[model samples]
Target: MQLLFGIPTNKYSSLIPTTFPENVSQLMKVFFCLHYSYKYNYFSISCWQSLPYNRPTFCELYEQINKIIEIMIYIIWNQMKKVILHWDKEIRDCERVMLELTIAQNNQRLELEK
Candidate 1:
């Protein structure tokens, strides 16, 4: 969980009690302040379950982690696409401006020749 978010310190350390709460109220306080993603909070809490059998098996944990990774990859890909698109637009605008300036310079040369 700390890996997903960060290592809790100082005030943040208080959020995670010495022991897991029997109910979610204690956990809710942490989530409210941290504003953690629901999936991350759910997975972390599930792993912290009091009963070993209640917690996810190694295979289940692997599957859940993979799903989270996939979602993160998708989000990053979309953001990169947006950045690339913005760069493309800026490059086209710059090319258009350069062409206009070149045309103006050519007209000035023609007038000088005349």
Candidate 2:
């Protein structure tokens, strides 16, 4: 979902969803900002704009943002590992198949040479 000029819509309404989340409504706001920015990125900056920077920084709010970042990093690492493992297994299977074909060819050549 997305919001434009204070309206709501789906991802198909315009562009691909990819934005920084600063609002309580995580997915919706992220989509809205991304879709809106894909066209008018030069305009409208951030939700934190015009607000006092007196708010806590990531280091200051380590208990919050840091934990979220840690979990996200872990998830991404595991996903990447799974993809690598899957591809590696495929490569091993291909190698085994090639070896079997080579052995069969060699046996056929030996019988023909007899």
Candidate 3:
């Protein structure tokens, strides 16, 4: 989880807390930061269940993590599409401007030759 998100820290300390309360409660508080997605929060909370049996099994965790990855990929793909389209339009506009400028320059040369 820390690999996906990051190590939790508070205003008081730059390192991980040594105590139990700080490890659990303080960690949860840090997870509330805007950078964490809802899926990450839910997965982290489920894994932290006090009872071992209550926590997700390895298979379950794998499936949940895959789902999160798929969702992220889908979002990123859509954003990339939008960015590509925007750049495509910008390039076309620049080309049109350049063509117009070239035509104006050619017409000026023709006038000068007359």
**Tens digits of per-residue lDDT for model 2, 4-52:** 4222222222222354354544633433454423522322122223332
Worst 10 residues of 3 by lDDT: 5-14
Residue 85 in candidate 2 has what lDDT? Answer: 100
Q: Per-residue CA lDDT of candidate 1, range 1-114, in tens? A: 542333222122223555445575554454344334776666656664654566678998788767666866887999999999999999999999999999999999999999
lDDT of 1: 0.65
Q: Estimate each model's TM-score.
A: 0.67, 0.49, 0.64
Q: What clash count goes with each model?
A: 0, 0, 0
Per-residue error at 52 for model 3, in Å?
1.1
- Candidate 3 lDDT tens digits, 1-114: 332233222113223335445566565455444255786676656665544576679998788767666866897999999999999999999999999999999999999999
Q: Output the lDDT of residue 25, model 1.
A: 53
Pick the winner on lDDT between candidates 1 and 2: 1
Q: Model 2: clashing residue pairs?
A: none
lDDT of each: 0.65, 0.52, 0.65
RMSD of 1: 9.3
